[model samples]
Each structure stands twice: as C-alpha cells, then as structure tokens.
Target: MKLFVFDLDFTIWNAGGTWCDSTHPPFAWKEGKLKDQENRWIYLYPEVKEILSELKAEGHMIAIASRTNAPTIAKQLLHMFEIDHFFDAREIYPGSKLTHFDRIMKELKVAKNDIVFFDDEYRNVEDIRSIGIESVLVTNGLTKDLVKPYLTRTIARDLPQSEAC
Candidate 1:
C-alpha cells in the first residue's frame, strides 16, 4: 500500500492565521470544537476526517509530517479529533520539510516513489517533489476529489514500464 503523509496546522486544523503556541497547554475538545487555554477555538477542516477515513479504509498508511513547534499540542489535537489512530507514522517537530520526510521515510521504510504527501505550502510541495515523492498542494484544505488524481497517477506510474502503455 502507498504511504500518505500530511501536514497539520492549516492543512488539517484551522489555526486562524496563527501558529499554535508551544507554551499553551493542550487544547480541549468540547461539543465539536477545540479550544485553547485562552478559549480561542481551533477547528479541523470539514473534509479532513472523511478523506482520512476513506484513505485508511482503502488500506493506505496515513501519517503526519508537521513542522509545528508545538509538537505536543499537535499530538493532543490529533487525538482529540480521534484521527490519531489512523496514522501509522508521525514526524511532528519544528524542521524543514526535507527533514520531516527523511525521518518519516526511514521510520516507515518506504521509498520516495511509494509515498504521496499533502501540504498547504507551495515550498513544501516543491521540496517533496525534489525528493521524488508525489505531493499535492491543498490550497483550501484536503478533499477526496483533490486527492484522487494523485493516487491514480501514482498507481499508474508505479506500474511496470511495459505495462504502463
């Protein structure tokens, strides 16, 4: 199965144009909203859960490759959303996208060609592509339709050269 990696922050949850403060305690999930210590609300994009669920159900390995400084809070948020269990690997920390993917590939034992990444940043898309991984830029956040073409293309590309025709 292919490994699918994702970014957090704007890519998963809407942080309201702000980075999650590493100093704040973990967020609290209540009545479908995640609130910080100061009661600032953060929400997962509406389509994230459904897309992730479908990918997991299809036997693809899901993972997180966030550059959030607040790694602890990121983990808490994932668990709060109840989607943490879907991830088979996670590389959450403050670092370059290259470092994040390097660790993720090593931990998962997957090659660059076998992985697909989704991020909301253009620079990240470029970085991932430089390493031979297929990446999708999630401008308005992830949706099933946005991901389908990449999956189809990757599957076809991985086919034997003779069979690709």
Candidate 2:
C-alpha cells in the first residue's frame, strides 16, 4: 500500500560512468550488455532487479524520479534493462526531486506519508524528506537489504534527519 520511489542514474543504474544525459544515445543491448553508441556500458547495480521484483510481487507501488537531463535516454535504458515493467509511474526530468514527487503524488493519488523514496544524492533525499516522505540516501546502490524494513511497514513516516546519516 506504499509508493516506493527511486531515482535513476546512480541509484538504479550507472550510465557509462556518468549521468544518462551525458551518455550517447541510440543505446543497444548487445551480448547481454546494454551500452551506448560509444560502447560504454550502462549497467544496473546488483540486487536492483531482485528488490524491484520483490516490491512488485508484494503489490506495493513502484516509481522512478530522476533529475537526469536526458529523460528519453533514461527511459531507453530502463527498457533496455528489461525492468520497465516494474515501475508504476515515472517522473524523469531535469529539476528538483520535489517537483517529481509532486507530480507523482498527483498522478498516483498517494500521500507523502505513504511514499518511501531512494536516491543517491543527499540533496534529493533531503528534498523529499522535507515533505514528510521517508527517503533513504543510497550511496553504494539500491539493494533488497536496504529497503526490507520499509517494505514490512504499513505507513513509512518521515524521520528526523541527522548529519551522520
């Protein structure tokens, strides 16, 4: 019954060691690897698919919110990764993560209290948390272990921010 939001780029996948906007387009999936035109591999972090599937199987909503300048490229990568079916909503654009959440809330009709977000950027985590959404700051990558506790909860409320976290 919760809306699980995720940021692209470093949170879900790394686009050739850079943001999706910087990677050359016309990306192709070749030999089980997804790469841009320049042959730079755009890869999802390990455990991403497992956790996404786990959320979907449990009937929890899933979405993507990214500030990448290349929304089209990001979508392409998502599809190329064969994980596009996992998302219920997507707000991929260049702007504050707050804007993305606002649109997602309006579209999905979900309250901020029901949304648990994950993002690699500290600023984005702070932005979503300011609105009373529980957001996890993803540093290494997204993993099932990272989101397990939140999944078991019914309403994941906001937490007080700390410098150490």
Report every candidate's CA lDDT: 0.81, 0.87
Q: Cα miss at 49, model 2 (Å)? A: 1.1
Top lDDT model? 2
TM-score versus the correct structure, for each prediction:
0.84, 0.89
Stretches of candidate 1 exceeding 4 Å from the true structure = 151-165
Residues 65-147, model 2: lDDT tens digits? 99888888888888888999999999988989889988999999998788899999999999888989998999888887779
- lDDT of model 2, residue 159: 37
Prediction-by-prediction clash tally: 0, 0
Q: How far is candidate 2 from the true structure (C-alpha RMSD, Å)?
A: 6.5
Summarize candidate 1's per-residue lDDT along 26-79 as a digit string, tens digits. Answer: 677667677877777877888888888778777788888888878888888778
Q: Would you list the clashing residue pairs of candidate 1?
A: none
